[model samples]
Target: MELKRTNVPFLLSLALVVLLALLPVTKTWAVGIALLLGAAVSNTVPSAAPSGLGKMRKLALNTAVVLFGFGLNIGQVISVGGQGFWQTAVSLGVIISLGYFLLRFFRLDGDTMKLITFGTSICGGSAIAAVSSVMKARDEEIGVAMGVVFLLNTVALFAFPLLAGAVSLSPEQYGIWCALSIHDTSSVVGAAAFLGDTSLSTATIMKLTRTLWITPIVFVLSLRQGEKGKLSVPLFIVLFLLASAAASVLPFPVLFKSLASAGKVFMAAALYMVGFGLHRSVVKKAGAGGMLFGGILWSVSIVVGYVLASLS
Candidate 1:
């Protein structure tokens, strides 16, 4: 009976993901609606949700990211990645350095500080999740980190495009800005998608380059802590690159296009799971200082990123 109860929510959630995927919703709307739906379901029957739901969410997201590669041009990826490398490295260093001072100023826990910093500087929840494993962070700390990032990412999704328009940024400039500044690949791509295809492509490639920084960061932390956690490029990123390479050579235009479209839907589905996982308790536990630190750090990152994007 307990097993059956758990299965019901899982199946229902799956159906909802598929249903939403078929709708003609924009990326922003899909993410927003899916999050609301997940929150509603989780809040209504919180206990009935499966414990493995988070893992499933990650799997869905990774798969979607890999599929997204099918749409990219290998030459473009190489060009964008090359251009963004130094900018990404410098940005990461600055964000982490500022985060350290803020950590001391706020008197927050070290583990939470690292988690938030990684999320802010790298790839939002993905960075937090990766670092948490090596750092052996408590569930609560991870929750707080993710919750803070989530709130900020949601704000960026809406505000960034409007900001870009107000500044009269070209699509390419907006793309670089979004890739440099935004928290997650999902949010970055979503915000850039609002601008146009050029923005979308540029943001995706540049953000993926930024994400590559996670491997070295995680590896160094693991060595320092003597934690033998798995150290490698995230599998999804490798697969995404492979898919891009194959798309460049393989003559599967229709198939690649379909997969890319499916990837967006799956990404939206993952957003739903992300929302469902962030319970109110977690948000409350994020604390005022943690929230302030993340918000302030993110704001500074935005300004710095925009400057770099303009100069680049």
Candidate 2:
């Protein structure tokens, strides 16, 4: 009985993961549910919630990223990269620069700023996870960053598809717009899939191209950390690349797809754990500045992306 009592949080978290897997919702919904559940449980049953979930969060995040590689088609990513390299580069640069200026105006902590910026400039949750591990960010900071991204992602998932018609965007144009504007690959894919197969394929390739930037940016961030004697590249990043490469070469489509799906499940579960860290104090620390920064940056990204896509 005592053992079960001690394990309620873990068991509840596991049940949430299973529930997420059974639901036919978008990644955004799954994460939101898990986060809300964790927050509620923490407030009501604080004793059941553990003081630390860092190890599990990090492990789950890394494993999910590596497995996500299985869903990539290296040829598609390469072709998209070759063609849209400059576009992505310019967009990322613009967003990062904008983020730096926004930081001056906002009252967020440095780590939170970096997390939000990287997440916005690149691939939302995955970018936050990768950079957070490198910086050894606080659990509260990670939760806050992800929460901001989550809110925006939920808005995008619903809004983009609706706006596609308003903007008179063709499937190709909408796909490119979604790739550039949406923060997460899952959300981008979800939004594009609503348009049709052409949009889905284009968005996936373009989003994957953006994901490729994760390696270089993370490497640069690691070097800048100046941990003089401990300058080792993260193993998960390497494995993520290798997994993509193997997927490109291997003929086991069924297996790879299954792994990728499992990765999504794990990511949802990890996000639920991330929520456990979000108490009132953490949310307060995140401040209105963090939310504003995300909202403004995402708005700019949407407008710019729309213009670029229309031109293309």
Candidate 3:
């Protein structure tokens, strides 16, 4: 198939992601630098270019998750997921409760409050997008919420590894902490990617498990708002499970290793795309109040996750 001109940037980004992953330098540093490069150049790129690139990015992420599943047995994934279940549940509860009181105390606009609450408590921008539709939030409210989440996601990508190192956390500990605290799947996966392969796998399973909460959260929100809300299931998770099952049952070590390696490359590429989506215009639209609210909530989540990880 002939590639379109619009696809050149995305293709180049993918190639860079793969090359960085393969280089002799530290994997974590390579990924981090690539992410920054993408974010820096995002503003100069045509806005229309990213719409198609976004779809391609999601496809790459799903494929990567499935392939990465080959590195773990199905049972291990289940066990790790089970351990993370409570963390997700408790973190969601805390965020909602704190957000409720904080919103009242701050007397923020209702729609903006809801947007921040959903974005912080669930899967960041995806949750904000889903909940806003049901709540009939204004474009400005949605934009602010998304901007807040995106900004925090960027911060998390850079800060998490440094914090993890300072605390001397194990790979599993770092993974669980990331799943509990990070605002988006992309950020969670990106932060953990630098830690190690084991960290990446654990974080992916935990983050995906946390993502499943979207259905129940949205259903509850819809009822409260007396409006219809759509639930989006991350089907890539099912594919991930299937891949793990295949790895457990099938006897193909060499093939599985190759698939897992490719998965890492794809993951790096997906993160690069994520970085590319961050722009200053979005941050400006978020406004000071929205940024403060999101910042507070995100900070609390990080503390909670750290405490939980330390205790575990």
Candidate 4:
């Protein structure tokens, strides 16, 4: 059989995984490099080149999150989450309220405004995808929102760690700030991991908690728009919690360690996929006004979250 052209991107991605695995750099660096490579190459290929990689990306990420849970005990997850629940809730409300007002001030159309608001206020593309359905957003609107959100997320992946160091934030503080400020779960975990393993765990749990807000946010949107929207939960979170519970009860030190290590590698690969999905045309279509709106909200979130975290 002749070689299929569609498999080229997949093969390239797999080769990247192998090369990065052999590098002496940290896993976070490997992932960052992979992301850069993916973004650089994304514009060169057909739009369809990366389409098949989405499922692989999702599976890799879910597996990574579940495996990462092996490093935690359920109690730690519960305790940290409970302590920060009020802070997270307040931050979410602040972000949404401010984002809505600012987008309107910028005079963005309703669909675009809602897309950017949900993307920034919640879990980036996932939030956009969920709320767009309820709002009956056009395809172009969804693309624009996702493009803007992903671009900001990329900025956060690099900028956040530098900000953390400049401000001398503790790992816990950095993690909480990442959860509150970053646009997506992958970027949140990536930025936190750059800080250290403790920050990674804290950020992941806090980010997952933030994701739970998706259901309620969608519900509110539907109520206001008089449109029906199905609530979709990321089941991997349930698995992550279950894995933490199992780790707490089981005597599998070697097994847990192995899984955690593998999970880090999987996460790096997932980040690589994320970077590959970035398309310049889509970002350009998002328009400068939408980007400015997202930037304003994101900047405020980082500043507000940092202050709250420092206080707590």
RMSD of each: 2.6, 5.1, 2.4, 2.3
- lDDT of model 4, residue 76: 89
Clashes of 2: 0
Candidates arranged by TM-score, highest first: 4, 3, 1, 2
Q: lDDT tens string, model 4, 89-116? A: 8888898888767754777777787788
Count residue pairs with overlapping backbones in model 4: 0
Tens-digit lDDT track of model 1 for 1-312: 135665587568757766776776544466666766777777777876676776878888788778888999999889989999998998999999998877667777878987999999999998998889888999988988998898788778778977976875778888999999999887887778777668878888899899999889988999889876455777888899999999899999999989988887887778777767657776788889889989988988999889888886
**Best candidate according to lDDT:** 1
User: Which runs in model 1 stand beyond 4 Å of their true positions?
Assistant: 1-17, 25-28, 226-231
Ranking by lDDT: 1, 4, 3, 2
Better candidate number, 2 or 4, judged by lDDT: 4
Give candidate 2 misplaced runs (Cα > 4 Å). Answer: 1-7, 23-32, 102-119, 123-179, 182-234, 309-312
Clashing pairs in model 3?
none
Instruction: Give the candidate number with the greatest TM-score.
Output: 4
TM-score of each: 0.89, 0.67, 0.91, 0.93
Candidate 4: Cα lDDT at 215: 90
